[model samples]
Target: MTIKLNLIAAACENMGIGKNNNLPWKLKSEMDYFSRMTSKTIDPTKKNVVIMGRKTWDSIPTKYKPLQNRINFVLSRSNLDLKNCKDVYASNSLESCIEKLEDNAFKSVYETVWVIGGRHIYEAALKSDSFHRLYLTKILKTFDCDTFFPPLPTNLKKVSDPDVPEELQTENGIDYTYNVYENTQFGK
Candidate 1:
Protein backbone atom coordinates (compact mmCIF):
# COMPACT_ATOMS: atom_id res chain seq x y z
CA MET A 1 0.00 0.00 0.00
CA THR A 2 1.16 3.52 -0.71
CA ILE A 3 1.94 5.68 2.28
CA LYS A 4 -0.72 8.33 2.85
CA LEU A 5 0.74 11.75 3.70
CA ASN A 6 -1.51 14.58 4.86
CA LEU A 7 -1.20 18.24 5.81
CA ILE A 8 -3.41 19.92 8.43
CA ALA A 9 -3.30 23.68 8.86
CA ALA A 10 -5.23 26.86 9.62
CA ALA A 11 -4.43 29.71 7.27
CA CYS A 12 -5.52 33.29 6.67
CA GLU A 13 -6.46 34.86 3.30
CA ASN A 14 -2.90 35.99 2.84
CA MET A 15 -2.01 32.33 3.46
CA GLY A 16 -0.72 33.59 6.76
CA ILE A 17 -0.25 30.84 9.31
CA GLY A 18 1.32 32.73 12.18
CA LYS A 19 2.32 36.04 13.67
CA ASN A 20 5.06 36.44 16.29
CA ASN A 21 5.42 32.66 16.51
CA ASN A 22 1.78 31.93 17.31
CA LEU A 23 -1.45 31.22 15.47
CA PRO A 24 -3.23 34.37 14.26
CA TRP A 25 -6.51 33.48 15.88
CA LYS A 26 -7.87 31.63 18.91
CA LEU A 27 -10.68 29.66 17.40
CA LYS A 28 -11.73 26.91 19.80
CA SER A 29 -13.12 24.79 17.01
CA GLU A 30 -9.86 24.99 15.13
CA MET A 31 -7.95 23.88 18.23
CA ASP A 32 -10.43 21.11 18.81
CA TYR A 33 -10.09 19.95 15.24
CA PHE A 34 -6.32 19.95 15.47
CA SER A 35 -6.30 18.05 18.74
CA ARG A 36 -8.75 15.46 17.49
CA MET A 37 -6.97 14.96 14.18
CA THR A 38 -3.50 14.62 15.59
CA SER A 39 -4.44 12.68 18.69
CA LYS A 40 -6.04 9.81 16.79
CA THR A 41 -4.31 6.45 16.89
CA ILE A 42 -4.63 5.31 13.32
CA ASP A 43 -2.37 2.30 13.77
CA PRO A 44 -1.86 0.36 16.94
CA THR A 45 1.62 -0.70 15.94
CA LYS A 46 2.88 2.66 14.82
CA LYS A 47 2.35 6.18 16.15
CA ASN A 48 1.48 9.04 13.83
CA VAL A 49 4.20 11.46 12.86
CA VAL A 50 4.00 15.25 12.80
CA ILE A 51 6.58 16.87 10.52
CA MET A 52 7.23 20.57 11.03
CA GLY A 53 9.80 23.30 10.54
CA ARG A 54 11.97 24.48 13.40
CA LYS A 55 10.06 27.69 13.82
CA THR A 56 6.81 25.79 13.89
CA TRP A 57 8.13 23.48 16.57
CA ASP A 58 9.26 26.47 18.58
CA SER A 59 5.91 28.11 18.10
CA ILE A 60 4.13 25.34 19.95
CA PRO A 61 3.66 26.26 23.60
CA THR A 62 6.01 24.63 26.11
CA LYS A 63 3.13 22.68 27.59
CA TYR A 64 2.27 21.24 24.19
CA LYS A 65 5.79 20.76 22.89
CA PRO A 66 6.79 17.25 21.87
CA LEU A 67 3.10 16.56 21.55
CA GLN A 68 2.02 13.54 23.50
CA ASN A 69 1.81 10.12 21.82
CA ARG A 70 3.16 11.29 18.44
CA ILE A 71 6.53 11.40 16.78
CA ASN A 72 7.75 14.92 16.17
CA PHE A 73 9.99 15.54 13.17
CA VAL A 74 11.59 18.98 13.13
CA LEU A 75 13.13 20.22 9.89
CA SER A 76 16.07 22.51 10.49
CA ARG A 77 19.67 23.07 9.52
CA SER A 78 20.57 24.50 12.87
CA ASN A 79 21.70 22.36 15.78
CA LEU A 80 19.01 23.47 18.17
CA ASP A 81 18.12 21.21 21.04
CA LEU A 82 14.48 20.43 21.73
CA LYS A 83 14.26 19.57 25.39
CA ASN A 84 11.77 17.07 26.83
CA CYS A 85 11.09 15.65 23.40
CA LYS A 86 11.28 11.89 23.35
CA ASP A 87 10.92 11.44 19.59
CA VAL A 88 12.31 14.49 17.89
CA TYR A 89 14.39 14.26 14.71
CA ALA A 90 16.06 17.24 13.12
CA SER A 91 16.86 17.18 9.41
CA ASN A 92 18.57 19.74 7.23
CA SER A 93 16.37 19.23 4.18
CA LEU A 94 12.91 18.03 3.29
CA GLU A 95 14.34 15.22 1.18
CA SER A 96 16.28 13.97 4.15
CA CYS A 97 13.13 14.06 6.22
CA ILE A 98 11.24 12.05 3.59
CA GLU A 99 14.12 9.64 3.39
CA LYS A 100 13.90 9.12 7.12
CA LEU A 101 10.20 8.41 6.80
CA GLU A 102 10.90 5.85 4.08
CA ASP A 103 13.66 4.27 6.09
CA ASN A 104 11.37 3.94 9.09
CA ALA A 105 9.15 1.55 7.10
CA PHE A 106 6.06 3.70 7.48
CA LYS A 107 4.23 2.10 4.56
CA SER A 108 3.54 -1.08 6.50
CA VAL A 109 2.96 0.62 9.80
CA TYR A 110 1.08 3.90 9.96
CA GLU A 111 -2.20 4.87 8.31
CA THR A 112 -1.26 8.52 7.99
CA VAL A 113 1.76 10.78 8.13
CA TRP A 114 0.85 14.38 8.94
CA VAL A 115 2.84 17.45 7.93
CA ILE A 116 2.01 20.15 10.45
CA GLY A 117 3.89 23.31 9.68
CA GLY A 118 4.43 27.08 9.87
CA ARG A 119 4.89 28.14 6.24
CA HIS A 120 8.17 27.16 4.61
CA ILE A 121 7.81 23.50 5.45
CA TYR A 122 4.23 23.47 4.22
CA GLU A 123 5.30 24.99 0.90
CA ALA A 124 8.17 22.53 0.57
CA ALA A 125 5.97 19.48 1.19
CA LEU A 126 3.20 20.72 -1.12
CA LYS A 127 5.70 21.24 -3.92
CA SER A 128 6.97 17.71 -3.48
CA ASP A 129 5.59 14.99 -5.76
CA SER A 130 5.13 12.65 -2.80
CA PHE A 131 2.41 14.53 -0.93
CA HIS A 132 -1.16 13.63 -1.93
CA ARG A 133 -3.61 15.51 0.29
CA LEU A 134 -3.99 18.72 2.24
CA TYR A 135 -6.43 19.13 5.16
CA LEU A 136 -6.69 22.88 5.52
CA THR A 137 -8.76 25.15 7.75
CA LYS A 138 -9.10 28.38 5.83
CA ILE A 139 -9.58 31.00 8.52
CA LEU A 140 -12.00 33.86 7.84
CA LYS A 141 -9.84 36.77 8.82
CA THR A 142 -6.51 38.39 8.06
CA PHE A 143 -3.93 39.17 10.73
CA ASP A 144 -0.52 40.80 10.97
CA CYS A 145 1.42 37.69 10.05
CA ASP A 146 5.06 37.03 9.54
CA THR A 147 4.67 33.53 8.05
CA PHE A 148 2.55 32.48 5.09
CA PHE A 149 1.54 29.30 3.31
CA PRO A 150 1.85 29.19 -0.46
CA PRO A 151 -1.18 29.50 -2.72
CA LEU A 152 -3.08 26.31 -3.45
CA PRO A 153 -2.00 24.38 -6.50
CA THR A 154 -4.43 24.67 -9.41
CA ASN A 155 -4.04 21.07 -10.52
CA LEU A 156 -5.52 19.63 -7.35
CA LYS A 157 -9.25 19.20 -6.80
CA LYS A 158 -10.74 20.32 -3.49
CA VAL A 159 -13.52 18.58 -1.55
CA SER A 160 -15.08 20.35 1.39
CA ASP A 161 -17.88 19.77 3.87
CA PRO A 162 -20.99 21.80 3.01
CA ASP A 163 -22.58 21.75 6.45
CA VAL A 164 -20.19 23.90 8.44
CA PRO A 165 -21.88 26.22 10.95
CA GLU A 166 -22.40 29.84 10.00
CA GLU A 167 -21.28 30.95 13.45
CA LEU A 168 -17.67 30.25 12.47
CA GLN A 169 -17.81 33.24 10.15
CA THR A 170 -15.38 36.01 10.99
CA GLU A 171 -16.53 39.38 12.23
CA ASN A 172 -13.42 40.83 10.61
CA GLY A 173 -15.06 40.60 7.17
CA ILE A 174 -13.68 37.26 6.07
CA ASP A 175 -15.14 33.83 5.37
CA TYR A 176 -13.55 30.54 6.37
CA THR A 177 -13.82 27.09 4.86
CA TYR A 178 -12.58 23.64 5.73
CA ASN A 179 -11.19 21.93 2.64
CA VAL A 180 -9.48 18.75 1.62
CA TYR A 181 -7.59 18.63 -1.67
CA GLU A 182 -6.42 15.52 -3.39
CA ASN A 183 -3.78 15.59 -6.05
CA THR A 184 -5.16 14.77 -9.52
CA GLN A 185 -2.40 12.23 -9.98
CA PHE A 186 -3.95 10.27 -7.12
CA GLY A 187 -7.24 9.91 -9.01
CA LYS A 188 -9.00 12.31 -6.66
Candidate 2:
Protein backbone atom coordinates (compact mmCIF):
# COMPACT_ATOMS: atom_id res chain seq x y z
CA MET A 1 0.00 0.00 0.00
CA THR A 2 1.48 3.30 -1.11
CA ILE A 3 -1.04 5.36 0.81
CA LYS A 4 0.51 8.48 2.26
CA LEU A 5 0.89 8.51 6.02
CA ASN A 6 1.90 11.84 7.51
CA LEU A 7 3.46 12.22 10.94
CA ILE A 8 2.41 15.44 12.68
CA ALA A 9 4.02 16.67 15.89
CA ALA A 10 5.00 19.63 18.02
CA ALA A 11 8.36 19.41 19.74
CA CYS A 12 10.46 21.68 21.94
CA GLU A 13 14.16 22.50 21.60
CA ASN A 14 15.07 19.23 23.27
CA MET A 15 12.65 17.18 21.18
CA GLY A 16 10.30 16.87 24.11
CA ILE A 17 6.66 16.50 23.18
CA GLY A 18 4.89 15.76 26.45
CA LYS A 19 5.02 16.11 30.21
CA ASN A 20 2.79 14.18 32.62
CA ASN A 21 0.79 12.79 29.70
CA ASN A 22 -0.19 16.21 28.31
CA LEU A 23 1.25 18.90 26.07
CA PRO A 24 3.63 21.02 28.15
CA TRP A 25 2.77 24.27 26.43
CA LYS A 26 -0.63 25.76 25.68
CA LEU A 27 -0.43 27.59 22.38
CA LYS A 28 -3.86 28.18 20.92
CA SER A 29 -2.51 28.87 17.46
CA GLU A 30 -0.38 25.74 17.47
CA MET A 31 -3.37 23.72 18.58
CA ASP A 32 -5.43 25.25 15.83
CA TYR A 33 -2.83 24.35 13.19
CA PHE A 34 -2.76 20.80 14.44
CA SER A 35 -6.54 20.53 14.34
CA ARG A 36 -6.71 21.98 10.86
CA MET A 37 -4.02 19.74 9.36
CA THR A 38 -5.19 16.46 10.77
CA SER A 39 -8.81 17.11 9.94
CA LYS A 40 -8.28 18.08 6.34
CA THR A 41 -9.25 15.61 3.60
CA ILE A 42 -8.92 15.95 -0.16
CA ASP A 43 -12.37 14.53 -0.74
CA PRO A 44 -15.36 15.90 1.10
CA THR A 45 -16.79 12.41 1.58
CA LYS A 46 -13.66 11.05 3.24
CA LYS A 47 -12.03 11.83 6.60
CA ASN A 48 -8.47 11.52 7.87
CA VAL A 49 -7.41 8.79 10.26
CA VAL A 50 -5.39 9.78 13.29
CA ILE A 51 -3.45 6.77 14.60
CA MET A 52 -2.39 7.44 18.16
CA GLY A 53 -1.31 5.45 21.16
CA ARG A 54 -3.88 4.67 23.83
CA LYS A 55 -2.42 7.27 26.21
CA THR A 56 -2.64 9.98 23.59
CA TRP A 57 -6.22 9.00 22.96
CA ASP A 58 -6.97 9.19 26.67
CA SER A 59 -5.22 12.54 27.02
CA ILE A 60 -7.85 14.20 24.86
CA PRO A 61 -10.83 15.31 26.93
CA THR A 62 -14.04 13.31 26.76
CA LYS A 63 -15.85 16.31 25.32
CA TYR A 64 -13.58 16.16 22.29
CA LYS A 65 -13.29 12.37 22.32
CA PRO A 66 -13.68 11.55 18.65
CA LEU A 67 -11.67 14.62 17.67
CA GLN A 68 -14.59 15.85 15.57
CA ASN A 69 -14.37 14.93 11.86
CA ARG A 70 -11.19 12.83 12.03
CA ILE A 71 -11.45 9.09 12.33
CA ASN A 72 -9.72 8.19 15.61
CA PHE A 73 -7.82 4.92 15.71
CA VAL A 74 -6.33 4.12 19.09
CA LEU A 75 -3.51 1.56 19.08
CA SER A 76 -3.22 -0.52 22.21
CA ARG A 77 -2.33 -4.07 23.03
CA SER A 78 -4.64 -4.09 26.00
CA ASN A 79 -8.23 -5.28 26.00
CA LEU A 80 -9.86 -2.05 24.89
CA ASP A 81 -13.59 -2.17 24.59
CA LEU A 82 -14.43 -0.31 21.39
CA LYS A 83 -18.11 -0.18 22.25
CA ASN A 84 -17.40 2.28 25.03
CA CYS A 85 -15.67 4.61 22.60
CA LYS A 86 -18.27 6.46 20.58
CA ASP A 87 -16.53 7.27 17.30
CA VAL A 88 -13.15 5.74 17.91
CA TYR A 89 -11.79 2.36 16.84
CA ALA A 90 -9.36 0.15 18.76
CA SER A 91 -6.48 -1.65 17.06
CA ASN A 92 -3.82 -4.03 18.33
CA SER A 93 -0.98 -2.09 16.76
CA LEU A 94 -0.24 0.80 14.46
CA GLU A 95 0.46 -1.49 11.52
CA SER A 96 -2.79 -3.34 12.02
CA CYS A 97 -4.71 -0.10 12.25
CA ILE A 98 -3.28 1.06 8.94
CA GLU A 99 -3.79 -2.30 7.27
CA LYS A 100 -7.40 -2.37 8.37
CA LEU A 101 -8.07 0.94 6.69
CA GLU A 102 -7.68 -0.83 3.35
CA ASP A 103 -10.64 -2.99 4.21
CA ASN A 104 -13.71 -2.40 2.06
CA ALA A 105 -15.46 -0.70 4.96
CA PHE A 106 -12.80 2.02 5.26
CA LYS A 107 -11.21 2.18 1.79
CA SER A 108 -13.71 4.76 0.68
CA VAL A 109 -14.04 6.73 3.89
CA TYR A 110 -10.47 7.74 4.75
CA GLU A 111 -8.48 10.34 2.89
CA THR A 112 -5.13 9.79 4.62
CA VAL A 113 -3.67 8.50 7.87
CA TRP A 114 -1.77 10.73 10.26
CA VAL A 115 0.46 9.15 12.88
CA ILE A 116 -0.35 11.45 15.78
CA GLY A 117 1.57 10.10 18.72
CA GLY A 118 2.68 9.33 22.21
CA ARG A 119 6.37 8.34 22.71
CA HIS A 120 6.13 4.71 21.68
CA ILE A 121 3.99 5.28 18.65
CA TYR A 122 6.32 7.92 17.27
CA GLU A 123 9.39 5.80 17.88
CA ALA A 124 7.88 2.74 16.25
CA ALA A 125 6.59 4.52 13.18
CA LEU A 126 9.83 6.36 12.55
CA LYS A 127 11.88 3.19 12.91
CA SER A 128 9.57 1.26 10.63
CA ASP A 129 9.70 3.96 7.99
CA SER A 130 5.92 3.81 7.83
CA PHE A 131 5.37 7.44 6.96
CA HIS A 132 6.23 9.57 3.95
CA ARG A 133 6.07 13.07 5.33
CA LEU A 134 6.61 14.60 8.77
CA TYR A 135 4.90 17.91 9.43
CA LEU A 136 6.89 19.01 12.47
CA THR A 137 6.59 22.22 14.44
CA LYS A 138 9.86 23.20 16.08
CA ILE A 139 9.18 25.02 19.35
CA LEU A 140 12.06 27.28 20.35
CA LYS A 141 11.68 26.74 24.09
CA THR A 142 12.70 23.72 26.09
CA PHE A 143 10.22 22.11 28.46
CA ASP A 144 10.18 19.44 31.15
CA CYS A 145 9.22 16.48 28.99
CA ASP A 146 8.75 13.00 30.39
CA THR A 147 7.90 11.79 26.87
CA PHE A 148 9.97 12.85 23.86
CA PHE A 149 9.53 12.86 20.12
CA PRO A 150 11.97 10.64 18.28
CA PRO A 151 14.63 11.96 15.96
CA LEU A 152 14.12 11.93 12.21
CA PRO A 153 15.25 8.84 10.36
CA THR A 154 18.72 8.88 8.80
CA ASN A 155 17.22 8.68 5.33
CA LEU A 156 14.87 11.61 5.84
CA LYS A 157 15.82 15.16 4.91
CA LYS A 158 14.19 18.44 5.80
CA VAL A 159 12.69 20.19 2.83
CA SER A 160 14.64 23.46 2.78
CA ASP A 161 13.01 26.90 2.75
CA PRO A 162 12.58 27.82 6.38
CA ASP A 163 10.15 30.54 5.39
CA VAL A 164 7.66 28.28 3.70
CA PRO A 165 5.00 29.87 5.85
CA GLU A 166 6.79 33.22 5.13
CA GLU A 167 7.19 34.33 8.77
CA LEU A 168 8.17 33.22 12.22
CA GLN A 169 5.32 32.71 14.66
CA THR A 170 5.38 33.50 18.36
CA GLU A 171 2.66 32.45 20.70
CA ASN A 172 2.66 32.73 24.49
CA GLY A 173 6.32 33.79 24.32
CA ILE A 174 7.35 30.63 22.47
CA ASP A 175 8.70 31.06 18.98
CA TYR A 176 8.29 28.28 16.45
CA THR A 177 8.41 27.38 12.78
CA TYR A 178 6.84 24.71 10.63
CA ASN A 179 8.78 22.46 8.25
CA VAL A 180 8.27 19.30 6.29
CA TYR A 181 10.68 16.37 6.25
CA GLU A 182 10.37 14.05 3.30
CA ASN A 183 11.45 10.43 3.39
CA THR A 184 14.28 10.59 0.89
CA GLN A 185 15.63 7.26 2.09
CA PHE A 186 12.71 5.39 0.60
CA GLY A 187 11.34 7.90 -1.86
CA LYS A 188 11.96 5.44 -4.67
- Which candidate ranks first by lDDT, i.e. highest? 2
Best by TM-score: 2
> lDDT by residue for model 2 over 1-188, one digit each (tens)?
65667888999999999998899999999898889888877699888888899999889998888899988889899978879765589999777876888688778888878889988888877765457888899999999999998867777787854433636899988899888888885546
C-alpha local distance difference test of each model = 0.76, 0.83
Across 1-188, the per-residue lDDT of candidate 1 in tens digits comes to: 24556888888877888888888777776677677776677467777878888988888888887877778889899887766568777888888878777875554555557999868888898877777788888876678888888888887877653333334555335567677788776523
Question: TM-score of every model?
Answer: 0.83, 0.92
Q: List the residue pairs that clash in candidate 2.
A: none
TM-score of 2: 0.92
Model 2, residue 60: C-alpha shift (Å): 0.6
> In model 1, which range of ten residues has the least summed lDDT?
162-171
- RMSD (Cα, Å) of model 2: 2.2
